[model samples]
Target: MQYQAVVRKFGPAAEAVEIERAALPVLRRDQVRVRLLARSINPSDIITISGAYAGRTTLPFIPGFEAFGVVEACGEDVYGLAPGTRVLPVRGAGGWQEYKHTDPSWCLRVPDGLSDFEAATSYVNPMTAWLMLHKKIGLRPGMRIAVNAAASSIGSILIGLANAVGVEPVAIVRSEESRARLSGSLEAVIVDRADSDLATGLAGRHGLDAVLDCVGGAHASILAAALKPGGHFVHYGLLSGQSIPPSFWSSHPDIAFSFFHLREWVHSEAMENVQRAYAEVAAQIAAKIIATEVREVFPLEKIRLALQSTLPFRTGGKVLLA
Candidate 1:
């Protein structure tokens, strides 16, 4: 049997080649066959294709991290999950396809009321936001935090999460355009880079207790300066194509800096721990406290277009492949 997929060939400048009939494998005893409904194209997906994920990406692989699907079939050992159950497959790289064969343990049941797009993108951004807020910083109500790339999917999730818990979220945007787009919907202090320095803007209002920085480079330095003494700065993404400067670390000797990656957390934690976190995030999604907005949905064959739409900037929502 065969299925359609977006295959990334080995080497640089390699486009995501579309394969109409890639060979499909038979299910193993602990596995289930999922008919994928929708999947999101995230920044990590692009980084994996560019061969820049610290050599973690292997060649000739299908490029996707999380996706929503229906259980079409299950192995003999796969109990509880029956056919037609909507599921979100985590911990795999072949989500940009029509079907996926993965361990039943890696799939989470999509909570009711979530659209295919929302369910598809539930894992990566939401899990990152939740863990960073709760586990890393232990952010409390009334605490102030600054988030770079505040218009991004994960940044928006952070804002919503902070708001739900009564934390004051200061969203630092790169331009007035981004500020305008976010101000109407998000309940936070939106600071446009064109109008104010990040440190100056943040200092005038309140001292930052923590910083969630997805955009690295000069923006990270500015965010670092804004943090109060003994505050933490968590760096998760390198959207600016530059890492944190060494001088900033030397200058801000009192601030704590940490790097976060979801893969590392998943690999190190027990299965039960991972499942519990997912369950909590799922509940939040169902409650509408954590949500994913879909900017667009393209069919599996149109993955090229979908990937293009999410390039190098925040689109205010996720771009999905269905």
Candidate 2:
């Protein structure tokens, strides 16, 4: 049997991606075959397709980090997971397809009550936000943290997590339009980049304990400057297409700056630990303490259109393929 998928040829153009059909490989003894129901387009997907991560990504690859699916078949050696179980595949690639054959160890059972949209888009942004808050920074209640890209899915989740624990979240957005979209709807102090300088607006005002920054380049410097003395500055995204300047670190010696990637964290942990983390995140999603707001859902055939939608500065929410 065969399934359709979005394939990325070796190149940097949107045209590099094409829809094609391929035979489904047989499952290995420790593997399971999944019928993918939903997947989301993330910034990392765009970056990988654009050749930014070319050194790491092989050509003619499928470019998706996470997806939700149902167990269609399991190898004889596979246990615990059975046919018809709702699961999310937590792998490095090959998610933009109708079916996936992967190790059962990489699959996490989706918690009951999460919609396909919630389960499909669950791993990357939510886990990044949750781990960064709980494991990396050890954010505590009553502490104030400033988060850039406040309207993004991860940013929204960070706000929710911070609020749930009594932490004060200050959302930094690029424009008033973004500020308006996020204000009142989320519990946080919203700052518009166009109206005021981020450092001046946040530094002396809030006594910020940390800056959870997804926007790199110049914005990262501003966010770093906004951090209170001895605060942590965590950079997780390079949406600006530029890396943080090395000079910023020397200039801000009192602040600690670190880069975060979810893959590294997952790789360092045992499989059982990974599964536990997924279950914890699923519980948060079920409780609505952390959630994804999808901007659009497109069929797998319209992958080009879906990829193009993410090119805009801010489309307000996640774009999913179903």
- What is the lDDT of every predicted structure here? 0.78, 0.80
Tens-place lDDT per residue, model 1, 1-322, is 5456555564332255565776678789888999998888877777777667637666678878888899999999999889998988787688878889998877778866777777888899999999999999997987888887887778778888888887757887777777766632343555645525665676665467899988788666677777788898999998778878878888888898999999899878887798889888888888888877888888887666766676654747788887
Q: Cα miss at 8, model 2 (Å)?
A: 4.9
Model 1 CA deviation exceeding 4 Å by range: 8-14, 183-196
Residue 200 in model 2: shift from native, Å? 3.1
Q: Which ten residues in a row have the lowest lDDT in candidate 1?
A: 183-192
Q: Write the per-residue lDDT of candidate 2 for residues 124-151, one digit (tens) a residue.
A: 9999999988887888977778888887
Clashing pairs in 2: none
Output the lDDT of residue 213, model 1. Answer: 89
Which regions of candidate 2 fall more than 4 Å away from where they truly are?
6-8, 183-196
**Of the candidates shown, which would achieve the greatest lDDT relative to the real structure?**
2
TM-score of each: 0.91, 0.93
